[model samples]
Target: MTVNNIAATFLLGGIALSTQAQADFLRDGKATLGLKNFYFNNDSREGAAKPSKTEEWAQGFMLDYKSGYTDGVFGFGVDALGLLGVTLDGGKGRSVGSTMIPVGSDDRPVSQWGRLGLTGKVKVSRTELRYGTLLPRLPVLVANDGRLLPQTFEGGQVVSRELANVTFNGGRIEHATGRGSTDRTGLAAVGGQRESNQFNFAGADWRVSRDLLAQYYYGHLEDYYSQQFFGLVHTLEFSNDQSLKTDLRYFRTESSGKNSSGAAGYRISGYTKEGDGEIDNRTWSAAFIYSIGSHGVTAGYQSVSDGSNFTQLNQGGLEGKGAGGASLYLYTDRLTQSFTRAGERTAFGQYAYDFTALGVPGLKASMMYLRGDNIKTVSGDRLKEWERDFSLDYVVQSGALKGVGLGWRNGKSHSQAARNQDQNRVFLSYSIALF
Candidate 1:
């Protein structure tokens, strides 16, 4: 049967079971509706290639429902998500790229589009098994939510927390729905067209001490690559309400199966080893943050090996395949560019302030700057780049619209090897709960 048919069957079956089960199944249920109005604009600076500008505006609706488990040793539950997007103002020339909305045959944004996702779950003690649509937040993969809607994966996952101070996660994903598309596509790397049906991952998070945490994860994409990740996080607190946080991450990736020999149409884009277009790379980063009351400062450094660009689940190369934008699990993944080129080194710093310290609650601002250099290119040219970003956010502190939020973000980047660009975004959002 088709995926849609399977999803419908799961939805109908869940409803039937919930209706006949104990009252706890429905009594403990919860639902929420979220509304968002978004505006996005990007301008390519002078001397840049491609279109000079792209602009779009849209409204989004998200309905989420989660049901509690039934009364039994092995409990059952269900979750449903409904997403809708409407174009407020956008045309063919302004919506050429699938930034916030998908483009149609006429190269214009569709009037409106939506999708429904459902998952059936079973719980036993502290362990849960879930099947169907999933939005996973793991070190190996992160669901993209930078647009009107969040990306989702199709498959099954198991999460267990039976051990104290430890959590385990494992899953198999077969398909993905882009944040801006209504259709689902098979899993593939950024520049690869051969789809892989088996993307398997397993990971565990361990809390070694009160202020220290460690993580390890392994991922394998059939005929593509295999990857391993290690992470460490620690925080130091002082009596004067001051704290220091440290984060370290590393990844080791190598090609597998068809990609190892550059056969079966499995080829990677960009720079790689001279022999074949195979994947082999190491990337790592370290970040430190200092916080005192409402004021915060951060500094970070990252490096990429000389073998190839950092690899992740990017579908930008799969045009007309229902996938568009993607995100990487790195601190250098920014608004204008990702500093993951081969042999690149990046240094970044940021400062943030919360207005509550100045008697203005629910207001905050932050600014960041990043500089990268020593980038390795196919022609052995050393490239350099930099970006600066600023953001402001405010929320209604009281009255009828107490929870309403407004945000603005602006970024500019200049590079010797990439495009120079400026981007801005504005968002208004609110959420209501129904129990």
Candidate 2:
């Protein structure tokens, strides 16, 4: 072990101390069970033939249990998550595929695939330490939560919120067993073929004021890649129900470990600078949103350098997962990457509104469009493409049958660089509390 490993171990101990410093006492917890009905369809915009059956159905349950620590200088707690997914319908002929449930032989959707996760934690003043399981969303690394159930990791985390309005988080993840796959694997670059066993990260986010926030993050994966990121977010309020929101993001990354040692990561094989392979990249995005009463509009632009594409904490590729809706978080940039090429730029816009302005208390809708260009592939091909997304949603606001929500989403894409995808989705969810 190196000095860094020793420091990480100490950090983990500190997390345990923050919570365990207090006296012992029983804590309170709550449990909720929700039922969701969903549907997904995708048409192949590219390929020799027309799109076929790409749809599926299932019933799922989520159970959560959390324990609080006793009052004192230190405390301890435990948490557990129980998940169950059952295939209500869908055969080989109609199965679209998904991560929550696996597909069987002949491309048939499975009857079910469920797993449980448990965690142990300790807390001290303004800081907490946890081990066992993790589902994270950070700048350099985060869990994917786009599917029916979120992907999870196994490791330890140290988080501190001691400063007023400023939070610091750091961790060393030793093992990652993907939620979608039954196997556990080491860390690897999105485009690299080699694997690694450790991923180290430290980050901070600060709310400078009521309208402004800033973030700084750094991450290093053993024998893989290293990255640095900075971001600024602000929300400006204007006239009646009108506001302007802005987000500025930037990243600097390069090959590392074995890549730096030669023949690893996305670095060109057998090519080394002073006996070390190297792949450097820089990317940034800026977005602005304006909202007035019932109408909201947004515009954004993102660009990626030609050296190497941006990377994400992907467990299992989304191939098996059926796509039906646009994800709001975690996996934000899906437009351009290594597999799709590089030196890319994307411009996008959205318009949305609330139905309450027209007397419909529980309804809303939005539409978005994105176009990407200047994509450079390894074969020296420049590719261009675009996509449009539309979504509508409503929730019950009153009466005995309140708290139910329904959603519809439609998307279309076209490209000269890769396979085009046309998709649609339907989702219905209800939340019930048993007190």
lDDT of 2: 0.66
Task: Give the TM-score of each candidate.
Answer: 0.96, 0.83
Q: Please report, in order, the local distance difference test score of every candidate based on alpha carbons.
A: 0.86, 0.66
lDDT for each residue of candidate 1 in 1-435, tens digit (9 for 90 to 100): 654566566546546664546476688889999999999898987764556788889999999999877777877777889999999987878875458888888888988878898887888999999888899888888888887888888888999999999999998988888888887888877687788888899999999999999999999988889999999999999847799999999999888898888884577777785646788899999999999999899999999997878887766666585577778888888889899988899999999999998999999999999999988776665899999999999999999999999999999999886779899999999999987
Model 1, backbone clash pairs (residues 3+ apart or across chains), number: 0
Model 2: weakest 10-residue lDDT segment is 323-332
**Candidate 1 Cα errors over 4 Å, as ranges:** 1-20, 46-49
**In model 1, what is the error at residue 409, expressed in angstroms?**
1.2
Off by over 4 Å in 2: 1-27, 48-53, 93-100, 105-107, 177-179, 182-184, 191-194, 261-279, 317-341
